[model samples]
Target: MRTIKPVQMRSPVLTVRRVDTYHAITVVAPGVAERFRAGQFVAVAVGGDTSSMLARRAFFIHDVKPDYGGTVEFVFEVRGRGTSWLSECRSRDLLDVTGPLGRPFPLPRDPVNCVLVGDGHGASPLFPLAHTLRRRGCRVDFVLGAAGAQRVFGALAARRVGETATFATRDGSLGLRGRVTDALPQVIEDARADVVYGVGPLPVLRTVTAIAAKYGVPAQVAVEERMACGIGLCMTCVLPVVGDDGVTRMLRSCVDGPVFRGEQVRFDDVGTIPFDALGAPGWKARPDDSASTEIGQ
Candidate 1:
């Protein structure tokens, strides 16, 4: 079992950079930096102390460094009011951050050929994971895609870390003109990948999972779901998943996963509860009607 040390701190922003389609912020957060693993996320309290936004914004940790005791970095696009406020933040500004949360990507014990797939800003987490794999003597191949070149995150970095890096863009601004899945088959075949790891939008992840299955390679996917609380209490990010015991249940993405084996998830039934799930209507045992009727008589 893994122990997580979560801390709520007013971390000082060390640096901020405006990447093509998003903003990357580095903060002086020792606890998060020291404890963070690839695929875990941080929940940041946006709009400062008196602001009206009650929920925290979640972001995947892009990187962590040893600088300033420790520093954690995350990248985000301004999709809404919360992220807009985060984008306007300047260096030395104090922001409330809670983090090192969620299950990290499980790594293989022995070195193997691995292919990593990411789409848009979802590519952030793959760099650190690739670094770890390379350290273990694993050959890492990267397949990254976006609508255009600017939308592609970590292209140069992926090239630097991976043994072979392939890109796909919808508008033909970079590499191939298609989705990541379009480029995946050739990359996997050429690399002779033994396993696959992916993080991205639901559609992209589903496609990646399908491709990996067709190739007979195992896949692990980190899903990007809309999280309101970033914790398990809200029950807002639940999705239907099958367990090892052959039962299906609604699992919270924030706690139960964000990372799950590709085969275990029923991608077609993600948004709605399956009729056969444990707690679904008519699935649970009902009280005996005869006993109740006799008491009433």
Candidate 2:
């Protein structure tokens, strides 16, 4: 896997289209598009130049087109003020964007059977990834889920991109009347998937990881976190992850990864640093504080 240095630029909004229950914003960003990799994302400066929102909102690139040099598309739901302001932007409006950040999904060296799982707007990144996987002679199957039909992001595109696309909605407004995980085990068995990839809420990734492990299939997952800087400088998005040496360390999601091996991530310890993690406070006292001595003690 390769990571390219990102560029910060003010790109004009090409279009803002509403798809399903999400908003898809396309920006004219040649630099970002030129370096764009599947599973990578862009950080957008919302609320305009004079606005008070200092934290940049990160969104995964849904598509990149070669129109007007290059254009990048990202999807989001208007949950708060940042996204609410973004939803109001129109064609010809300019947006400050920096991308294609974070470690992208690593492709296999040889063609393999791959199952891609996504929930809600998290399905955006998987579209580009699915296309790339197919080009490498891999069999791609999709398991997309959401709360309801309007919440499912890309049913039509998933159908066109993968060999088979299965959908589940809680409200039974889509294919199967359940969540993606409920339908995943059967899909894995039927497809004989060699590897699994997922992008969604933390809970979803955690469940997907467990299911993939049960089937003895390798999994790579992209995590969604509230990135304050989107550039690793803030240190606000650290999570405990096991290194190859078997030591758990706090790693930054913005730089270390938005993508990681499913089994290595400490999913249950995401929001808080684990006490046993390397360099964590009181790390030396975990097993036996009675025997452990401090510098002055």
Candidate 3:
């Protein structure tokens, strides 16, 4: 039971490096670094003090190190103005960061064979997760995929941490000539994976969930949704999820989870509220519309 504390800090950038397809930044935020767990993320205010970018950019914690007391690192692609601003960050520049947010990936109570699946920059969180899993005596395997060679985040790191690591690329520039899902079944079978953990785009998660289900292996997924307020107040990152009580409701990814039991999520209806979901309009409507009849009638 890890308690989450919401900390806001102005931390100095320790270092910034241009990875093949993304920028990696290390910031001296001891509070965040000490408390961070896999799947938790940080919301960074970009564009400096005078810039107009009000929305904080969210990134999964790539790694944490005990330097300058403690430091946290995150990786991201320069997808837009916010990230572009982040890219220009240099050593000693201060960044306003809010973090150690969101529920972390749950490690099993007993050691089990686990397969981690990540795609593109989404692979950021898997490294630390692998370390934790390995320390707990779990046999870890990795299946990482990207559009091309440079886009793959941690092939070398994966090999270092994982018992077995497999890579895939859409352009055949890597280990396999397909998506991660294409190589998943073989990996799962070879590893005799007892469970799976995945973090990536929704489509990739959906596929991983489906494959895990097919093999009767449990799957946990961390969704990558655009979050405005990582603290969950905004309700901007809601997605339909089915609870154990068998009711489907919109859950906020920021708080309720960015990580969830794969089978419990309505992946196909993520963007649209399902007609039968709890609290949905007309969800309890009578088949004959008798409930709408006037009392006088």
Candidate 4:
């Protein structure tokens, strides 16, 4: 397979259809939009510069209108330079982007009550998963967690798509002011879930996964990591992957995943994206600007 190169492509200015501060972006990029999946991501060349990596940032595809030639929308948060750039971008400006990379959410093999937990930019990937599950007649409760009112997004949009929505803000601005896990007691009490969908900070994912496991519920997490060669060669996006044998392997998050089972990941190594092999510099980690909603995908 040819590694997707930044050099040989014409960046498109994805006209903003709409924008949600700290929540989502609706853009019209029909060419790359149609091919994306819920857990899969697209690498965006910030400011359309191919030379210096502001790195090709990855976004979890939130809404994919296939009829619009795959024109899609993205919902995420503003964390650093790249994302900030994404926020400041004008409607008609062109930017380079690539692929529906990595594996998608595991469509549950057995039907069970599904609870979707969204935190920070982690919320982006679950939109499609929630919608698809609801269509299949599964009962889904979507809980969004944020530091304050500013971090939550698309509640009305989520409801329209068929998920029963709730919010847990740390500041108590609108909903519960505790951690996502803190809301679990009441949430799970109302409904016994078979599966839990989570996207958010490492600590949150760890806590969510632990809670689900304690209750015998299967949990899946949408993982995001820093990327460079979106196809995996750069190894800039290495995250722990669990194989059938139960051993955690460091897989290139770019190609292998931006999605992993909650139980399978090693959250202790969350942000330690190896700049060198075991922190050495001879094989230094490239200066990476490319990032995702979470950095362990």
Report, for all candidates in order, the number of backbone clashes.
0, 0, 0, 7
Give lDDT tens digits, candidate 4, residues 1-297: 232322223334455533345545555566555555567777777754544545677777777775534466676567777777777776666666566677777776556688888886578778788777877778788788777776676566656664467788888985788766788756765777888888876688889889988888878887656677687778887775555443345677766666677887777765564333323344433356222223332
Global CA lDDT computed for model 1? 0.88
Give per-model TM-scores. Answer: 0.94, 0.94, 0.94, 0.80
What shift in Å separates residue 136 of candidate 1 from its native position after superposition? Answer: 1.0
**Angstrom error at residue 55, model 1:** 0.8
Which residue pairs does candidate 2 place in steric collision?
none
- Worst window of 10 by summed lDDT in candidate 3: 288-297
| lDDT of each residue in 1-297, candidate 3, tens digit only | 657786899999999998898899999999999889998999999999998888898999999999998899999999899999899999999999999888889899999999999999899998999999999999999999999999998999999899999999999999899998999999999999999999999999999999999999999999999999888888899988876656677888987777889988888998898997766887884454433321110
lDDT at residue 130 of model 2 (Cα atoms): 95
Native-structure RMSD, model 2: 4.8
Off by over 4 Å in 4: 1-11, 17-20, 269-297
In model 3, pairs of residues that clash are none
Q: Which stretches of candidate 1 lie above 4 Å from their native place?
A: 284-297
Per-candidate alpha-carbon RMSD to the true structure:
6.3, 4.8, 5.8, 7.3
lDDT of 2 by residue, 21-55 (tens): 89999999999999999988999999998999999
In angstroms, the error of model 2 at 116 is 0.2
Q: Give the runs in model 3 whose Cα sits over 4 Å from its true position.
A: 285-297
